[model samples]
Target chain A: MQVELQLFATLRKYAPDQPLDKGLVMNVEPPLTVSILLEKAGVPLDKVKIIMVNNRHAGFDQELAAGDRVAAFPPVAGG
Target chain B: MTERYARQLNLPHWTPETQQHLAAARVLVVGAGGLGSAVLPYLVAAGIGLTGIVEDDRVDLTNLQRQVLYDTQDIGVPKAEAASRRLAALNPDVEIRSHRTRLEPGNAAAILAGYDLVVDCTDNSAARELLNRTCLNLEKPWIHAAVSEYFGQVTTLLPGGPCWQCLSGTGAPADPPPAGILGPVAGLIGSVQATEALKQLTGTGRLLVERLLVWDALLPGWAEFSYRRNPDCWACGRG
Candidate 1:
């Protein structure tokens, strides 16, 4: 399946070396998740605060369907 | 009535009749810090009939730059109380209610039950989650906004639509960002929130529902990303 991966805040650095706006695309195995993809992409799990797939909230175990757009953000500091 | 609202009452899009709906509306602001400071005043001035402020913290010396509602002497005082005092003074016609309690899962629903709309100005993940769930359960429209050093985001969560939890997931991310915010950034975002609330209340303009409007002051641009409901989302999902 082809999944679009996005990251925000400190996690933005892990966009596979792309600019912050251009999301990363990855061909990964099926039954994938944002957490699993992060591990696959070499992201330190400790750095992420929340994960959303196609803009809906998901758990680490939530499976990714084909064409899923995954956006990840670290805990940002702001009011 | 027209004479009272003659200023905004005459805006091309918004009129005295729309301002009446605003005066009859009840709004809840869930924080009194940076975003709340920027939002609450405008809502009151715009003629919102009732306003509720839910804040558990007291003023700190460090909050002066953005928390415009409180003064130097108000430090260490309850934020809700101080804010209500100032907001009440801004518009005597509006009813201001102060909730000096934390937004916890246990009290979320009850606190928001009576309001027409909610503006989320909170600075923490836990509170944000609770507010999202409560708003979902109540089927109320809510305006969500957040800001950082030079970046800000806002969204409107309407009933039967994708909610905040559905958009981000449940629980605090293991490592959430500390609530580090610059005053101006919050001011901008909060003002947007107040604008959305007015729009939603008066039935004018499109809302940000299901779309995350992200702005970068450093980049000096704005972008909105589309979103949908996660059928399995713990809070807003069908369950």
Candidate 2:
């Protein structure tokens, strides 16, 4: 299945594993959950505070579908 | 609709009624730091009748990097007091009140009780958590914005909508971890937050009710994502 992964804020620097910033469309094996997908995309789960599967709040264990948009971002905690 | 708001009133969908709404609205900004510095000026200049500031920290030299409401001489003064003075000078038509206290559990509700709306410029999750529960119980609308490094995000939280805890997915509140941030990053996010507050107050345009708008300076673009209210969430939900 092909999915678009978005790494926001400092999460954009992930490379050598995801190898792209902002939006990246790639093909991954089926049966992917948000947590496993983050691992495969080289985005550390610790850095992510909000997860949106196709723009809605989703859990890490939520299943992914074809053409799913997975956006993960860190908590931007500065004033 | 006098000469002060002539330019904004000329804007599309803005009129005498919108000006009246702005003039009659009472907004509370919790945190006199970067975001508050920006939000206060815009809202005051545009004419929010009563603008209350809830801040207990004194100004520091290090804060001058982005807290435009303070100056070199304001380093040792309390943030809310200094901000009130500066804002009063900017527009005498607006009322500026300084709470001079932090947003703790005992005082959050009382401070918020006097205002019709709130703008969250606070830097910690614990403050946001308290605000979410309080505003939800009070049925008031609020705008939430935060910044770090080269990015920030903003959203408008209305009564019966998805709240901070729904987005956080955590029942417990934590302190905001320190992070490096550029002055402009905070300024940009605060600017957006100010816009949201004004828009929401006057009932003018589409708001970020269910949407979280992200600004990435490195990418130099705006991306929006949505989140629905969680039925089992602690703050707004029956849980």
Best by lDDT: 2
TM-score winner among the candidates?
2
At residue B216, give the lDDT of candidate 2.
Answer: 81
lDDT tens per residue, model 2, B72-157: 99989999889999999999988999898899999888889999999999998778889998998898899999998888999999
DockQ score for candidate 1: 0.32
lDDT per residue for candidate 1 within B96-119, as digits (tens), equals 999889988878898899899999
lDDT of 2: 0.86
Residue B70 accuracy (lDDT) in model 2? 93
Q: How well is candidate 2 docked (DockQ)?
A: 0.55
- The TM-score of candidate 1 is 0.82
Compute each candidate's TM-score over C-alphas: 0.82, 0.93
Model 1 preserves the real interface contacts to a fraction of 0.36
Stretches off by above 4 angstroms in model 2 are A13-21, A24-26, B170-176
